[model samples]
Target: MTVLNGKGVLDGIAIGKIVFYQRKGQEAVKRHVENTEEELRRYQDAKEQEAADLKKLYEKALHEAGEKSAKIFEIHQMILEDIDFCDAITDTIKSERVNAEYAVKKACDTYIQTISAIDDPYLKERAADIRDISQKLIGILTNSESDTFTSEEPVIIAADDLTPSETVQLDKSKILAFITINGSVNSHTAILARSMNIPAVVAVGEELGLKYNGNNAIVDGASGRIYIAPDAETVRLFSERREAKKAEQEQLHSLKGKKSVTMDGKEINIYANIGRPEDVEAVLRNDAEGIGLFRSEFLYLGRETYPTEEEQFQAYRSVAENMQGKQVIIRTLDIGADKQADYFEMPKEANPAMGCRAIRICLTRQDIFKTQLRALYRASAFGNIAIMFPMIISVGEVRAIKQIIHAVQLELSGEGAAYNPETKLGIMVETPAAALISDELAKEVDFFSIGTNDLTQYTLAIDRQNPSLEHFYDAHHKAVLTLIRITAENAHKNGIFVGICGELGADLSLTETFLRMGIDELSVSAPCVLPLRKKVMETRMDR
Candidate 1:
């Protein structure tokens, strides 16, 4: 028996042994590559093959998407041409590096290092799959048996780690909250779990002989507790806690559309951070005060070309119509590093995080920028809309964006597109430089929405995606808090408001901390709106 600590929502009676789950998608990709090699030769043999044209279109599409994606696409080409990853695996059979397992691990390490250096979380997740495939291939070559046991009865499966694919594949009705011995707060698996509203506990070091056979046990996902053989009394207490929590969730949901004011009569704005059209239903159901941080990346994925202006207009309109008269702060396309949609067909990049991404991509790709800006502008006439630019590093980018807005005004007028001229345009202060110059930037943009996620990452020189550096990526760091203070003071000095649209916005206990920093508004996920509002209603702002 051993003790461990973790955090997740508590659901009762799930007992099973640990099943380490990571990305196992490599075998499929490898199989595709193997099949495509022959297809490549066949295409080359054909006189009318248009590989060059396809490559050119891919290149063009990425160029329009953003700089980080363009760089990523470049690397993707390099991997296909330079890194004979397939050839390397084939040659491993001739001269074993050490043993079959060691060779597989070596291949995995090489591929992991290669992709882990990538900035995109979506692409980086594939690294583990590469290792998984290499392991599978080595086993096949060595004639080693793989885990083929299946369980008929529902059991609480434990794990060392989980990938997005694994979490999604799990039958949620059977599998309870996920527990991982190793995982980050920002991994795609974690994000998917949260998106599904499933209970999950990460970072539990494994040292227990949990039974594979079914046994009555309690799993506290919120508190990160796993009981192999819980006592009747302990199980009963957890049951009560679970019921109370569910009731509390219901109570919070009932507070939707009510108010987010505190006990001390301080009224704080609470809004939803939405991305998809389906989320509009969530916003309407929850009665969110407004839409804050409307991510436009989802539209950028899943196709060969950029989404048309009308398509963007429809998406933005859905959210705007749902909001009715409430204010909606739409953050312009925050693409590039973290959330690269597949439509971009971006090349793999070496240092995509530091490279041109998000608003920096918006700067060069002003044509695409105008399309979104035009859509947002067109939608503005339909509701209370404010524009936010992501990843601002200088006053020059703000001015340049203003010029684009001027250009958009001209185009809109020529095209007879209705829009709100007085709609507030804001900048997301996510860089240390931006925060340091917030006082100056406040004079330009209508307001400042401090994006604490990247702000903390940039300020601490910690890549939020890098688990090795996660120890330093804390939002509670004194340095990051000081920057938040500076940003708020500057915004207030300029008679402009400052809002926070990050995960930190939803942290109920940290409300007072942000209040002390003088943040004016709070933006969180749609479902989190009411709980956050209720927290605000009970919180005293005048600290």
Candidate 2:
């Protein structure tokens, strides 16, 4: 048997033995280098030994996957100090005198063909991070210490894509699942294979390469398929459908401390949506209940500048003291559209998702929105810190974000510091003019998340990164669920509270139509909080 399929971001099941991964290094000849300053000091000692091997793969992806997979090795050490990728490999090693591994393979094939001709699928997956830092700087100017892939058993792998330092230098218990042939389920190797729950599948094409190496595949990942050399009655029908998806994820860990409530009871918070502060240990191992979208632009993507207010108050006081008191919110700097950040020199925008993004660059840069509202009010004295704002569309930009958060709470109460003057403030009813004035922007913010992926890419004017408008991209379009039921009925007719962080808040078929649209919260992605709290405890709003 053979099968194939593709796009299943993550699930579970991997019968393995495929392999393709090879990174060693070999082709970079173009000689004639009569010492162009010893090939620019051997290309600055192979870019300082690939920036000390990307700072030990960013501290082994911040201790085995966190801080959004260790911010892809801090954006590959800021694309190895990109001055147009080190002036196209120091002008091709001093204008073609060549040899610094053939001017880093002709400046990484003209910087991965100018970022794969950017029509921005997030800068075409950053051309797999300039082919993973030009194959580890031409395997460190050709000494080539073969970087990863040596499995004796647990296989699968396949590649053509996978770069967050080759998926954090493999050996994830020999990796029994991986497939690529091109990527992007927002790749950093699909966010470290959904934070290492493993079982992946991505754009599977190039007929899954290396001519099926060790053969015997399987994969499945809850049916994105894969198979390859199958039979034996298709491996006993996918080994009893991978033991019923490993006993339905061991019964979603017994609904993780329960209560997302619903049968006829209602109660729903279920939050969890982060991007840094070490994703609060997968939002406290998926129990969630808080952090409804901290994405404070990962302290301004891959830095070069701007992450200062004491480095955004020690990363919002380390996720509000590790969410001990829960509720985190955050969201302020949702950088320009498609999340660009060339030191925010932002300009060329023929529709950067309706340009000047997220609270229009924090209301035309109120000195970078009062230095991130004085680091989220001095990390709101370390707990329950709330503050949102992202691509909002006025009650005058939520009264100009409460006058720059009341002038950053009077300069953190006149520098006497320690804050939290009743923090809470929100926005991001993601744009149908803030969901048709969610009742006057829900009486100026105390809640409302609903960023349904840019409110279904600005209510189906569609271009959710156009893979030919994925069949008119509908995140269940009844006009994007009537603008998330008119911003959850004008946020409960103004008593505020409303949620849905986006990606249609982890669409388990729109989780019982966003709990019949009174949707007090959803927040997703911490492996979709126990499958959206087991689809809100097997729904039944009175059947």
Candidate 3:
């Protein structure tokens, strides 16, 4: 029997378990992970074989149909090959002699502990991804069973949290809605659901709280709402609405292959904000104008030490090559609050966010910074490359950083390094002081990117993590908006471009506001590219 709780906007509903993650037997955990990993490799081999066979079938189908070529699968596979890490994780689990669940939990805890020691807020967010992946590998080893879907019935699965891997485990045709007692909006579980286009609700209190064996519910993922055992008419309405939304999404898909310009001819740059190099494909699919906010922290996080220059160069070069001649803005290594770069020998600061981060860290750690700069410059020879400095608050600091950039340029030039000298230099206006002094700083930097997230938090003196103060940290607040306006004004006055590389840039509701402020670019997540592009194409700037 399940004890269900009907929280506001969420109706407690009964759910049945279709699949489950378990704590594999201690000794068997190692064997289980090994077997699963081997199974995956075998599956890959099988896929390769099947794909070859299917290729002939696909060619036949296309030739017979005499229609435009239809892809059986994506052109380039964005293989998230964390196999080495996974193997290492399995080894650690076996050596630690911990239970499967505990080993998985420990890996997540270790990642948290490591990342919690960094000062860069951006890198810190990645810890969430780490935890999500940890949960995934654990589930893979323990939850040998998988969820299956048939038209017969829609089942509800209960879990502490749904990971990207766990979500992928569900039978797409049969799995209806999943409820998790854990996981927040920031968790990758939610992101996975969004990508999979499934209806899921997280933080549903508890598994037992759901009515067991006798109840049904619907999950409204878009609004993060849930419907309990509704009457027939209500269910019908929801079903109809879902179908309508699906149709609408299909319509939205038509906007692809179109330019992201407003009706009134206001050109808003719809760029992709990517993390992994593999995510670059989404940019091309979404027809993103360029890459904005390319988080380089991924190259360092979860590593024993910093990536060598060649390692960094290859990673950077991948984006430049994939972009195929589009602009790509790469921010220097931003490892601080919530980000622990293990091999960097960085001491844990009392307040990492305000401590050594972004340009500050680059200044203090010249060896790492120059390597990155060298990589960036070298990659610049490949395409349109722009380097952005984060958390810069002073004109003096920007000038000092410029000197360092020049120094690197000189050294690389002397070494006959293959690089670009014309790479643009930009600064992130995250600190209030930076925004306030933008008029003066704009003259020094080539461009200005307002990092509205931090700027909002700092300008209002609010800790964003604290729910109580969230109301005060509104990016649209008059003060924050004024600052953005002032900063953009300053940049325009100095004949420098201004763009926003924050969540505000992607907020469709705030697109008008950004356009009103004369923002030059709007960088957003890859998945959001099309909708944002469509939004921009629909909107008109009243300039």
Per-candidate count of clashing residue pairs (backbone under 3 Å): 14, 2, 12
- Relative to the unseen true structure, what is the Cα RMSD of model 1? 7.7
Worst 10 residues of 2 by lDDT: 465-474
Q: Candidate 2 lDDT, tens digit per residue, 1-543?
A: 778888888878889688788766567888887779988998898898788878777767766766556767767787787788888888888887888888877888887788777676667677778777887888778887756678677788887877777787888988888888878676778888877778899888887778788888898876677989998988897789888878998999888988899778888888888777876887898788888988887677654677888988898898889888989998888777656678889887888878888777778878888988887888888788888888777688778778777887887788798887888888777768778878887887788888877777777778775554576676787887887898888889878888888777887877888888788888877877898888888889885
TM-scores for all predictions: 0.75, 0.38, 0.71
Task: Please tell me which model should have the higher lDDT, number 1 or number 2.
Answer: 2
Off by over 4 Å in 1: 1-127, 131-155, 158-162, 179-191, 201-211, 341-350, 541-543
Per-residue lDDT over 440-471 for candidate 3, one digit per residue giving the tens place of the 0 to 100 score:
99999899988888898888877665443445
lDDT of each: 0.67, 0.81, 0.67
Instruction: Give the range where candidate 3 is weakest over 10 consecutive residues by summed lDDT.
Output: 67-76
What's the lDDT for residue 411 in model 2?
Answer: 76
Question: Candidate 1 on 75-98: residue-level lDDT in tens?
Answer: 333332334664554345335423
- Clashing residue pairs in candidate 2, if any? 358-391, 359-391
Q: Model 3, which residues run further than 4 Å from truth?
A: 1-155, 159-175, 181-197, 202-217, 222-236
